[model samples]
Target: MQINCTVIIQAFNFLITYLFLRKFFFHPTVQLIKQKDTAKKILAEKLKLKELAVSNLVAKKNSDLDAFRYSISQRYQKPEQAVIQIEPNVLSKQEVIVSPEVIEECKNSILKGVHNAL
Candidate 1:
């Protein structure tokens, strides 16, 4: 088979066109895809970092709340202890100071309640 000059020229033109299109179009498109992938990766990493920061803040707030609760419990415990200590002493030292008239009134009220119940 004899080689034709037109065929050789056509093959060369096709190769040039392929290389030109790859350089101008395909390479830039691939680069743009790579850039988008890189941007997505960076954004994902930033989101993870922010999530970690928020979790740490929540943990800190919970710990602070626990400490506050502990302090309030301690403060209330002192008042409760003082009241317990004072209660027995106050009860032991105090005497019932009912007068004769008040005792008679209490008896009369009790008799009235019994009569109403019957």
Candidate 2:
């Protein structure tokens, strides 16, 4: 039950410090964190949109290339190579892509088989 001058002064000092920190330090720090979160979200959305655009462009390019190949194959029809036209359907259905080296090896093996048959 001792009410002194020092206790009152100390209580007032504590209140002022709390108010100053809340206004200058805590509020600004919280606002900065919110701003950074919003910036990251905006960047992520932009990246996703760009990725979608790139994927669409790639799909269009692939379709155009396929159309060009089909047109060329049709224009250059060889009567002597009727097997090639028939084989393309089977190869397209398989969707198998082999390297040029593998194709060369396969050609060599076919030629050897033809020679052995002869």
Candidate 3:
């Protein structure tokens, strides 16, 4: 069988044009669209992750606050040590705090047993 020159030339032209478009136009266009789609998907996922993180942080903070409130509400949590701790220069409603001279005299009377043993 003999091939026609016109048909063969037309077939060659079609192949070259298709290859050129695929290499220089269609492939890059498709790749660009794919890249854009991937970027959009990534951005959406990032936004979702950020929202979840914020919600988790808020939930954790609320839980901590609730725990703290519950702890404080449970009892007369004022420590015994605080009641015993002494501050300088304090005066009662009827009594005044004298200087160290009077304080030492009062201590001797209060601890009379220790003084006798010594």
lDDT of candidates 1 onward, in order:
0.84, 0.86, 0.83
Estimate, for each residue in 4-115, the C-alpha lDDT of model 3 and write its tens digit: 9999899999999999999999999999999999999999999999999999999999999999888887864654332233456555677776899989986976576444
Best-fitting candidate, scored by TM-score: 1
Off by over 4 Å in 1: 78-100, 103-118
Supply candidate 2's per-residue lDDT for 115.
63
Give the per-residue lDDT digits (tens) of candidate 1, residues 34-103.
Answer: 9999999999999999999999999999999999999999877742222112223533555868899978
Candidate 2 has a TM-score of 0.61
| Worst ten in a row by lDDT for model 2 | 81-90
Off by over 4 Å in 3: 68-118
TM-scores, in order shown? 0.63, 0.61, 0.51
Q: How many backbone clashes does candidate 2 have?
A: 0
User: What residue runs in model 2 are displaced by over 4 Å at the alpha carbon?
Assistant: 78-118
- Compared with the true structure, the alpha-carbon lDDT of candidate 3 equals 0.83
Ranking by lDDT: 2, 1, 3
* Candidate 1 clashes between residue pairs 3 or more apart in a chain or in different chains: none
